[model samples]
Target: MKIDARSTARTLAEIGKWRGVLLYGDDLGLIRERAAQCVRQIADSLDDPFRVALLDQEQHGRVEEEVGALSLIGGRRVVWVRDAQDALLPRVTSALAIDSDTVLVIEAPGLASRAKLRSALEAHPKIASIGCYPEEGRTLIASLSDLFRDASVAVDREALFWLSSVLGADRAAVRSEVEKLVLYAGEGGKLSLDDVQDCIGDSANATLDDATTAAMAGDRAVADIALERALADGLSPIALARACLSLMTRLQRVLDWMDEGKSRQEAIKLLKPPVFFKKMDSFTKALERWDGAGLRRACEAVQGFELACKQTGCPDLALSRRLIAQLCLGPRSFLR
Candidate 1:
């Protein structure tokens, strides 16, 4: 049966009933977290590599062969096929029919509503199809409430708003930060707005936002400080670079929309993955200072830096720093 996001807890609670699970979603982060949950249900330790067998694109096609091979050990086994596609349905169906102690998990990108694989999984007696979509608006609020309820924690009303404002659609991040908050509060303690701010606030988002805004506005000192803070927080050079590129892409799209006669608010509304309400104004201001030319230069710089990181003997960190510095200090004449 197909599982909804709200039913995630209930499904997790009764996961043992299903023999095979197919987790596919738009949110790669949530898909991964659910896959891990399934693995943890069967695995004692991730350190034991044998506990789970991970199959990539090439190996995933051989599912029937892999499952048909006898396992010397009678213990339960989990075969996880990553980046799953429709091509594996036949083998996956065969694997599920073996009536063995093995569970097959297929993780893929978003599947169509009438997809054959998804429909087959839903109709199959022993398999559970899980949809891992990002929570938004009311769904997000409900999910948050469910999480806190499960965590046995009480959250203040204002605290909920603040926490939600800072959080994106990353379920694992939300759970991790909440777990931290729960640990900090101890038993029977209530979570306040201050607690949310101090424990669950999104420092990473702030750092990236600051760095991107500063860079776009040509504020060298602020950009330098924000980039430094990000590095200190263990953000990888490549990841930081991607963050910059991603922001540029968003701003450029908004600019494109505005050039086509859409207003700032309308352009913001047109954004895919819709900007958080709290960050709408920030993005609008960014749209003002961000233009196509700056975006092209930044993209080239980010691409070159990524290539350098991939090639051995390249100073990845230094190259990353230089890219950010140049974007902030160069003669781009930011539209602001």
Candidate 2:
């Protein structure tokens, strides 16, 4: 029998004591998680405890030999084969055929619908297969919400939208960020946009925003603070330099487009991934502070820093600090 990922929880709970199971998915995390659950289920069903073996690609042949040789201690034996590929499938199939009280659990990357392995597993009355995939649409949003709820944190709609937009590419990263947000918020607290900005926000991008905001308003103090924070975060000199260059480049482009009678929205649309609405104010301010010439000079300085990083044996943290100090002082400060 083949089961869908969403139905896995209930299916595991109700699964009969089958002789074998094959759990496969593209996502390794989900595959391992489900496999653990299945092992627990088998343990619960058996009167006497069973032995569990984890076989990887390299260990599959040896494990298959062991499976063929071993008998149930007092109950069923469970063997878990992970990272199963085409080369190991035949051995696994042969091992599964042995008429013993042993159960084989197999995990693989993925399988085609018409593949021989799929056909064999489907034909076997004693085998069950489960599929896991990346979550989508409502499932994705719901999972995010559940993470917040589990952490006892209340996530507003706007906050969820912001998070989903920024961190949705990797589910694991999203979960980590949500956990961080929850921890930052503490008990019985609501997560606000400011909290997100303060805790889990992209520091490099945040630094750029702060610097751009201050520079546009001609506030040297704020720009200096942002530069200092970026330095303290251990960003390499070359990385910081590149980021500064990119920020200035973007500001220049936005300014040029706006000057050509383009609306802010139109400029944003032309930008890849479209700038987040919250970042528009910072971009507007940055454009006011630096002209095309100044932005070009900043890019040039970034190239110089890249050379320094390559040539010097100095520790990366120290080099980064020195670079930020120089940038904070002014373009001329880089000369010293």
> lDDT: which candidate is best?
1
Give the candidate number with the greatest TM-score: 1
Residue-by-residue lDDT tens digits, candidate 2, 127-221: 77777654433455677888888778897776765564344223444556677888888878898766777786564343434553444445567
**What are the TM-scores, per candidate, against the unseen true structure?**
0.57, 0.51
lDDT of each: 0.69, 0.61
Model 2 C-alpha lDDT versus the unseen true structure:
0.61
Q: For residues 23-80, what per-residue lDDT tens digits would candidate 1 score against the true structure?
A: 8765666788778778778654433455577788889777776555544555566777
**Candidate 2 residue pairs in clash (backbone atoms < 3 Å):** none
Q: In model 1, how large is the Cα lDDT of residue 49?
A: 54
The ten-residue window of minimal lDDT in model 1 covers 327-336
lDDT of 1: 0.69
